[model samples]
Target: MSGTLVVGASHAGIQLATALREIGDREPVTVVGAESLAPYQRPPLSKAFLHGSADTASLAFRTPAFYAEREITVLTGERVVDVSPTGATTDRGRHLAFDRLALTVGARVRMLRVPGAGLAGVHHLRDVADATRLRRALTGATSVVVIGGGFIGLEVAAAARALGRPVTVVEAADRLIPRAVAPVVSEFYRQAHERRGTAVRLGAAVTAVTGERGRATGVLLADGGHLPADVVVVGIGIVPRTELAEQLGLSCDRGIVVDRCARTSAPGVVAAGDCTVVGADRLRFESVQHATAQARAGAAALLGREEPVTEVPWFWSDQHDLKLQIAGLSAGHDDIVVRGNPDSERFSVLYYRDGALLAIDAVNATADYLTVRKALATGATIPAEHARRADRRLKEMLVASLDA
Candidate 1:
C-alpha cells in the first residue's frame, strides 16, 4: 500500500492522522511539521499560557509514545519547500513519497506594516514561539499597546491586565470583534474591558510604531496622537498558508479550496483546518472544532468513503472572568433578540435573518450556547418572542418549539 503524507503538524493534521487509524486505515502515515516542538494546543497560548498558568509541557496534544505505538512517523523541525504529484521535499533536502497528500498547513499572522514594527518590543502571537517571546516581554513590560481588537489582541490585553500591566487596545473599527459579532455584543465587550481597567480606543488607526534605540517606545496614531508603551502586540488577522497548494496547481481563493468532504482540486489530495475555504459559500472557520470535524471528513474521503463535514460551527473565548460561547454563523442577520440583561454579565444574543435563526452569542451562558447549538444542528429554531423570555431556560423553549 502507498503511504499518506500529511503536511503541517497542526490540530487538523494530527487529528486527521488519528482519524485514519480509528477508521482502520493501516497504510504508512507521516506527519511533517516545521516547528521543532511536538504538536500542541493553540487556544491556550493566548490565554492561560501567556498568563503563566500553563506551561510548554502542558501544550502537547499527544505524547511521543502515542505516535510510536500507532506506528506513525512524525518529523519535526522539517519544512516542506517543494511539492509535486508523487512526493514532497523538505528544506533539509529530504524527499518523502506518498500516494495520498493532506495539506493542513495553517495560517500566518498578519504583521503590522509600519515603521518600528520590526523593533525589539513588537510581537505577534500566532504560535508557541510567538507566545513564549510575548510572555517574556510581558514580564518586563510596564504598559502594553495592542494594535488590534480581535480575539487574540483582546485576550492578550486581558492577560496583560491580569499581569498588573496597563493595556490600551487600539481598534480601527467602530467597535470590538465586529466581524464575528453583532454591534451590541461588540459594545458590551468594549465596556466590559474598560470596566476592568483596560483602556479601549475605537475608530483609531495606528500610523506607525515609534521606537527608541531599536525598541518600540510608543505608537503614533493617524489622528496625531501617541500612546506610550514598553511593549506592542499586533493581532490584526491572519493570512492562510496556501503557497504549497498553489504550487501544486490546486485552486486557491485566499485559502486552499476544498469541498465539504475536504477534497481539494487534486484527485488524491485533501485539506483541512484554517488553510481551507470550503464549499461555494466560501465558508472558512479557524476554530478547533471545525478543524477536527473537517479532518475526520478528509480522512473518510481518503478511504473512498463519502463523509461530509456538516456540523454547526462553534467557538469560544475567555476574557477575564467572562466566557463567551458562540454557535452558528451570524453573518447576514437582519434581526437579533436579546435575552437577559448584559449588566448581569450573563446573557445571549440570538441572530435571525428573515425570521430564520442564524446564530447565537452567549456570554457566561453555557446552557444557552448548548441549546442553540443543538437547535441549529437539528434545524430547529425558537421564535424571537419566545427567545426574549430570559427567565425560561432555552432548552425548555427549544423542546417546546420542537413539540409544536
Candidate 2:
C-alpha cells in the first residue's frame, strides 16, 4: 500500500511524510508529533534561540499550511503511547491503522538522578519551551552552573558569559565533550572556554544540588565541594524513545533495528530518526541531518521504491563564532590528521581507519569543509600523510589520485 504513517513529528517524521508525498505516494500521510508545536530545528534551541538571537517562527521546519497543502495529517500534542503489532495508540485515545509505519520519534533529555535535582532553577535544554524558560531564568541569574560539558551546556555557558554572568561547568569526564571529540579537539574547547573565564570542574561528579526554597543555589560535588550558582542547566545526553517500538515487538537494540532501507524487523513497519538504528554499518544518530535523511529513505522503502541509500552521516555544532561541521562517521578512526592551522581557528581534522578516509571535522574552514565533504561523499582514496598538511591542497592531491 502507498499509505504511510510516520510517528514522532520531529525533523525525521516530518521529512518522511514530505518525502513520501513528493515520491508520488498518493495515499494519506499521517505524522504523529509529540510536541504541540510544529517540527523545528533543535540545535538552535541551546544556542541562538536561548540567546535571543532567533525567534520561534524562524526555527519551524514547516508551516501548518504546508502540511495541509501537501495533504499530510499531523497529529500534534498527541503521544503515541503504544504501538501494537497492527497499529499505534495515542494518548488522547486514537487508533491509527497503518499500511506502513515509520518510527521517527527522536530522543528526550536525560535527567540526572541526584539529590535536589528537581529544584526550581534546575533547567534542562531539549525543546523550545525549555530554552524559553532557561532564557527567562538567565535574566536574574548572577551565576550559572551547568552540568555536563557537552555542546549544549557549553553553548549555554557562552551565552551566559556574554551577559557577564559567572558560569561554572561540572563534568564527570576529565575533558569536555569526551564522548564526541578526540582529546586534541576537547583540549581546544577547554582552552577556548577557559579563556572566556568559564570555570570548569573536570572529573567532578555532582552528588547533589543544594537548594533553598525549592530553587537551586549550588551543586555539591562528589568530594563534598559546592559550586554556588543561581541557575543550572543539565545537558548530559539523550535516551532514545524506544518503548513504543519495543511494545510492538520490533527487533530493538539500543534503537529500533532497521536495514539500509529503513524497514523494521516486522513487515509493513519502518523506523527512522534517532529512534532507529539504520544502515548495514549499525549506526544510529540523533542529529538533525541523520533524522531527515533516514526519514526520506524510509519513505522510499515503504513505497517499495528502492534507491541505494548513499548518504554520508553529517553533524554540525554552533559554538560562539565557531561553526563545527563533521562529514561522515568517525566511530573507529585510527589515524587522525590535523589539517590547517589551529592557531588560525580555521582548520579541518581528517579521520582515517586502515587508510580509508572515515570522517572530517571542520572548524570554520568553509572551503576545506566543502572539499573533504565531497571527498568522503565520492569515496575518494586519499593517503593519510597528505591530508594532515595545511599547504597540501587536498583538492589538488585528489586530482592527481591519492597514490602520490
Candidate 3:
C-alpha cells in the first residue's frame, strides 16, 4: 500500500518526502517525476549549468543511494495522467493507490506564440533538458538575442557574454526585471550589463523570430528594427502546472490555492511549490525558498504535526560577477534607502513603508544582507536616516535597535 504519493518530483516534492522522513514517519513514499534525472537544482541551470561550468551529476539534490536508504521510491520519466481521491494513474497504464497525496507539480515555461518561435535555434530554459539543448546551440554562436529581460534572460546573456559571444537583451517593459526590482536597481543592472558589452534594448517588443530554413537567424522588433542573432533565448515567464490539481477538481486561480499548511480544498491532498497560491493573500511565489518552506509545512500537516510555516519571502539572482540577494516582499513601499555605493558595484536598496522595513536588495554585501534579513523577519524598524547613512554600518544600526 502506498503511504504517500507525490507528483512532480521537483524541489518541493523532494523536500516534502525529505521532511516526512526527518520527522520519523516511516511510511511508503513514492515520488513521481517526468524528468529522467533525479530531482536537481533549477537555479544553477541558468548560471553554472548554462555556462557549462557545472555538470548534471552535481545538479542532483540527492544521490540514488540516499533515496534508497531513506526508503523513498522515486519513479522518473513517468507522467501522472490522472489523479483521483484514492489513486493516480500514469501514462503507462500503471495505477497506484495512495492514502495521502501531495502535488508538487511545478511550473512550465511560457512559450512565445510569435512566428518562427518553433525554429531550431530558438530556446527556452525551464528544465535541464532545455538548458542542455540551448547550451549545445550556444557553441560557436556569434550573436545571441535574448527575449524578456527577466532573471533567466539576463543570466543567459551573461553566460553567452562570458563565452565571448555578443548579446542583445530585449525587454518589452521599460526596464529590466520590472516585476521584481525597483527602477533604480533596474538602471544599475542595465549599466552593469552595458559595462560588460551587452546591448540592452528597453521598451522593445519582439514581433517575430526571423528564421532561415527552419533555424532562427534574427529577431524582428515591433519598432521595425532587426537584430542579427545565431541563438535566441526566451525568458518571458512561466505558467503553473496545475493540470493535475485542476483535473481533480481542486481550486485554482493563478495556481492551485493552498492554505498556510499547504492544504488544498480537496481533502487528503496537499500541494506545494511554484504551483501553489499560498496563504490568505493568494500570493504565488516562484522561488525555491517558498517551494521548500511550503513543502515542509505540507509534510507536517500530512503527518498531523503542528509545524506552522511563517517564512519570510526571499530570492536571489546571479548575473555576471554580481550576486543580487533580495529579502522580504516590497509591496506598498513608500520610501527607499540606499546603502553602500552603487558606483562601485556593491550596494543595497532598502524598501520601507511607514517606518517599517519592507524589503532589501543587497548586491555583493553578504554581511549586510544577513543582518537586514533578520531585521525584516523580526519586524525590526531602522530609522530611515540611519539606514541611508553610507558611512555607518548596517549591522551596528540593527544591534542598536535590538538593544533599545
Candidate number achieving the greatest lDDT relative to the actual structure: 1
What CA root-mean-square deviation does each model show from the true structure? 1.3, 1.9, 1.5
TM-score of every model versus the real structure: 0.98, 0.95, 0.97
**What ranking emerges by TM-score with the best candidate at the front?**
1, 3, 2
User: Which lDDT tens digits does candidate 1 get at residues 28-79?
Assistant: 9999999999999999999999999999999999999999999888999999
Per-residue lDDT tens digits for candidate 3, residues 242-284, read 9999889999998999998999998789999998897668888
Regarding TM-score, does 1 or 2 come out ahead?
1
- Model 2 C-alpha lDDT per residue in residues 243-274, reported as the tens digit of each score: 88888888887778888778888887888877
- Candidate 2 Cα lDDT to native: 0.83
**Highest TM-score against the true fold, candidate:** 1
Weakest ten-residue segment in model 2 by summed lDDT: 395-404
Query: Which pairs, if any, clash in model 3?
Result: none
What order do candidates take by lDDT, descending? Answer: 1, 3, 2
**Considering only N, C-alpha and C atoms within 3 Å, which residue pairs clash in candidate 2?**
9-33
Q: Is candidate 2 or candidate 3 better by TM-score?
A: 3
